[model samples]
Target: MIQLVIVTVLLLVLFFGIGFILNMLMKTTWFPIYGYFAVVIVFVVYWGNAGSLTDNLTEYSYADYIPAIGGLIGAILSGSAIKALRTRGFKMF
Candidate 1:
């Protein structure tokens, strides 16, 4: 309930901050989105708890997914923000 909401918001802020810094340093748009996916894949593989893809997908509860979705949204937003800033002549971004 409340914990889930807090966790989701925390993940969102965490991802956004990380992605924002990465974009600033790398000067690449959309890299954070790809990085996020790569990180998820690596974590899944490294944990070795993965079954078939469908099984893996079905096993997680909403509690597991909601924060992840939030984080993904954050990462995407960071990229968009960076792109918009750059477009608007924010050279540092």
Candidate 2:
């Protein structure tokens, strides 16, 4: 649906911007990726129930996955961008 697309894009941009900023501030290329995974793990731990791992993992639909994929791509791109900038002699500070 249109809403799903919009939400996915929004999440992608949101994560990208946040990750980019974090990279600049932290002066690290891959920290955002690690930070993203840590945040996801924390979120899942907070929202998941006492059920089995398979049951909990299977509960999410494409609607839940698409945005996460978008966000992950965004995070990855952010790190790449920062690395590229640094390699090109563009200081982040």
C-alpha local distance difference test of each model? 0.87, 0.86
Tens-digit per-residue lDDT, 1-93, candidate 1: 999999999999999999999999999989989988988767754454666766677767899889989999999999999999999989873
Report model 1's TM-score to 2 decimal places. Answer: 0.90
The regions of model 2 sitting more than 4 angstroms off are none
Q: On a 0 to 100 scale, what is the lDDT of residue 74 in model 1?
A: 94
Report the number of clashing residue pairs per model: 0, 0
Candidate 2 whole-model C-alpha lDDT, 0 to 1: 0.86
State every prediction's TM-score relative to the real structure.
0.90, 0.91
> What is the C-alpha lDDT profile of model 2 across 1-93, one tens digit per residue?
999999889988898899999999988888878988898877764468847666667878899889988999999989999899899999978
